[model samples]
Target chain A: MAKVGLFLGCITPLRYPGIESSTIDVLEALGVEAKILQGTSCCPAPGVFRSFDQEVWRALGARNLALAEEQGVEILNICNGCFGSLSESSHQLREDPKKLEKVNNILSQIGKKYNGTAKVRHFAEFLYRDVGLENIAKRVKNKQDHLKVAVHYGCHFLKPRMLKEIDDPERPKILDELVEVTGAKSIPYKDKQMCCGAGGGVRARTKDVAQKMTIQKMENINEVGANVIVDVCPFCHLQFDQGQEEVETKVPVLHLSQLYVLAFGLPKERMGVEAHAIPVNF
Target chain B: MSEEGEPKLVNPEFTKEVIKRGADTITLCFQCATCTGGCPSGRITAFRTRKLMRRVQLGFKEDVLPSDELWLCTTCMTCDERCPRGVKITDIIMTLRNMAVEEGHMAEAHKRTAGMLIKTGHAIPMGDKFRELRKTLKLDEVPPTVLCDPKLYEDVVKIMKATEFDKLIGERIDG
Candidate 1:
């Protein structure tokens, strides 16, 4: 139960504030103080900035981490992409003195210095590892056994298993186990570990290609008759939530935090189903 | 050189540059195609991660950098994880992309995204509509990001300037 600076990446705050509200609610219920990291920017986006300019990406990510450092807490990211950028940058900055010097050089212009001590945590991993499943299970006042969730661990949260080491990249069970804690069934589907096709700047550059990938995953989810898609990244959440409109699928999407909010039996309005393209059926 | 004496497309310097940019694992790729086999984007698009790695290893800078297929990788790291030779496939792709941007081959959409990040400190900048939604959610009008404080945003601008990212994308946008 360490304090966490809730790192709200762009999509969660700008596009899906419900995830923000619900995440805060769920964390408070679980007895974790979720501090808002003011003056934070984008995890600067991994695929876009990292692809375009690694130097810029590291500098911007360092600034965000520095913000959390000033608050004296671990940076808790709910989005897989944000986790990927911040954690990767933080890891590199910590391990490589030369790279740390380079990023600090950039930070110096902003009146900041990165000590490379900033720790980044994905919220799901924090809950699974720190909070423990039994504790989460105990807080579920409203069981969502009706929700057959197609759990998406999203790429960065698990893959590059060399770095993340969360679960078996090919056969992840973290999300499934977490989902089942709320009395929901995590339905196994084909290509369970597939990417949402929106990462690496592909969604922004090539919409049709991104949609094709989403449709493929949706087909697998639909075949399994999963009632909803549960994702850990706001980017993936956006892909499934909005991509459903193009593919004409009714399976709603929810961030893991939002799903927990529902399981906690908090007010439905806080989940912000109204902002969703595909309605949350349950 | 097939007797026609066509211009050589390879540039060893380009290969050296990619390695210098932190994807030295590019040399480890023996063209096993393991990177392509599991690539979700390659299944539907012309993006072949294995081929791209091959081109990089061969120093075919022209073939490697400017191709639209370079941007098609979703960087899922499936290929990176599955590589038996320990090639950091996604990292190589990212390195190639950075090199591509340096050569002025960025896609318009990605350039626009970079523009947004430069302007608002977020790749996806805030819209006026989200302000009302935040108020309805009983949250702050702005979510305490760089957008809330001009001085903090000025700090972001300084970082971008120091990195010359403002010059990289800004010059192209105005040009």
Candidate 2:
């Protein structure tokens, strides 16, 4: 059981603390030590900030990664946006020495630096590649035998394939396989790999466009009769969980950790299940 | 060939700027609508990712910078991932956005969110509802983040200041 720093992005801690709670609980259940990397700022949100200024995006991302690098542990990020920013920054900074020197110069002003030692891993990848599905399945005290789930990979988890390299961008299975390990069937849906309509700052800048995309995804989820929407990133979770409210759909949403927490037979109360906009009754 | 032909809208400098800003692949886009065809935002909004790619290639800075469609991209990278030409469509959009902001063309909503980030280190700052929910989860009312720690918040402010993010976004950071 290696020590991994949990990078809880802005939305997760502020909007969906339950995901954080569940992630911590599930990691403990699997005998992995979870350390909260304190003093970190936003993933600065890749879409909004990066759209306006790449240097600020890179520097802020480097700062967050520097925090984890100082702790000497790889990051275990639960949100796709954080995974994109931190992982992409680490990759870009390490691959390009000029960019590394430039970012380090900015970090020096704040007395921090990124040597690119800290690697960012999405939680689903952490489970699939590191924890092993069999090891996870062995601990499922309560099999979600009747549960049907629609897995939302969210764009950052698999996109820009050269950088993320988590799964096949066109056809992702790591998340689906993780869901299946808990006895829930990961149902295939139309445009299963489509963006959650909230990425790249769409939710903030354009409400109707975001809701329209959410409705489209919900229609697909509803078409498949999925009882729950399983996602690794909290931003995508917000789009499905809260975005559905505008469209008048009630499809329940669960973070991957929440499902694992349930499969471990942990009480739902421990994970703040009721806090969701759409109730998770299972 | 008559001298009355429509005036060219090209501004090669804009194209070169986008390329320098990391959208270097814009030149390879080849007018293929594959990006727009596969774009989820294109399906609903007025945002045409392919058209935007072409606009950048033609260097139509005025037409591209001030349009509301510029802010509508979700940056999903779906277009970039599936592009036949590997045009890095999303990165191009991001570069255009940066250029747009430099020209004072940021959408109001995005500006508001940027202001919030400068003020609180969060685009969507925590409110009372989240505090109550966190209490129910038995976690601290504010998770261990910049929200809970002023020192961290100051550190965030320092980074924003160093990067001139506050100034770029027109935020005034009081010492």
Candidate 3:
């Protein structure tokens, strides 16, 4: 059993409640003894500062991390964006001498510091590393059968080439491995490493561009002949799921969290499947 | 010729501002088309991600703004992650979107979606059917994370306060 700060990203909170709820369910089902940490905020993703104001992005991100540190718990992120930003910022705080000084200065004002403390774990990583796939398989009351899923790692969870976390940057298998625990087959695609085009406010920015990116992602999914795309981030799920029409393809999207919930025999309704852009048959 | 000439852009000022604010990652874009290829939203419409970045590089705000292309993006952050040049493509797109909404020029669907998101905290708009289904399944109602945790509300409130996101949507009743 491990203590955790459930770092639900912006999308999971407002868009994909199912993922958040299911993550809690899966973790609890695993008997890991998890608890949601209080006082969480936007990861202040590189989406904000690295593009507009690195200073604010860092300051704000440090603020989020500080809360996790203050609580004395490891950070478990559900969103790829938060995973990327938090991991990178944590890297900066630990390795980058200059960034640490600058971010620390801002922290002084907030009376907080990143402090090189606490490990940031994506929910999938948490299951693989902390709980182990075999351990999770033991708890699966219902394992999905004949379900084919295409895993979308998204970009933030795998890239920037420096976070150095998870498996392969282009072909990560943590999601696939976890899907196996639920008795689901994870498929591959041409654009498996492609971005969902939901970052940078693309969904809110303009539908045209959003659709363009969606189409490409869908093309990849279409080629794989998978019924669903299993993912971790809610934003990615939104971009691929709700944005699937925008993807110009009609494959359903499922968060790895939802799969876990279903594997525990949670009904589709309990997992928020109907709310998805493409309704899940099961 | 590509390196020697000015890249196409929608808003040079917006691009300049983005770059000046440490978004020089936009400057590293060499038009390798990785972002365009990797972009999930770029496959729709005529608005190519590469072209959008080009427009940003050239700082053509007039061209970039007021286009359905800008709002089309879902901001999944793929381009930024794959850019060998490390271009902050998502950042550029977000700034442009924020600017669009600030000016009250966003698409009606976008506004309605935002409204729905604000009101229900859920992207898809569904009525009592799902709620009743929740009851039938005996599913734990969507645990109001906000209601369950006031502290999160406070933190978000502060971040929004500092970012002035609310001010940007003045007099706009979010559905």
Native contacts kept, each candidate: 0.92, 0.82, 0.28
lDDT of each: 0.88, 0.84, 0.66
Tens digits of per-residue lDDT, candidate 2, A1-282, equal 557999877888888899988988898888887788877788878888888888888888898899988987788899989888887777878888999999889889879988878878888888888889989999999989788898888988888897887778998788889999988898999999888898777788788788899899999889989888999889899888888875555888899999988999876886776667887788
Q: For model 2, report DockQ.
A: 0.73
Q: Report the poorest 10 consecutive residues by lDDT, candidate 1 chain B.
A: B1-10
Clashing pairs in 1: none
| Per-model root-mean-square deviation over C-alphas | 1.6, 2.7, 5.8
lDDT of 3 at B63: 72
Question: Which pairs of residues collide in candidate 2?
Answer: none
TM-score of chain B of each: 0.93, 0.89, 0.70
What docking class should model 2 receive?
medium
Tens-digit lDDT track of model 1 for A57-104: 989999998888888999999999999999888888898999899998
Report the poorest 10 consecutive residues by lDDT, candidate 2 chain A. A241-250
Superposition TM-score, candidate 1 onto the true structure: 0.97
Q: Could you give candidate 3's per-residue lDDT for residues A9-118 as a string of tens digits?
A: 55665455667667777777787767676655556545433333344456567777778889878888888878878886777677767877776765665456777776
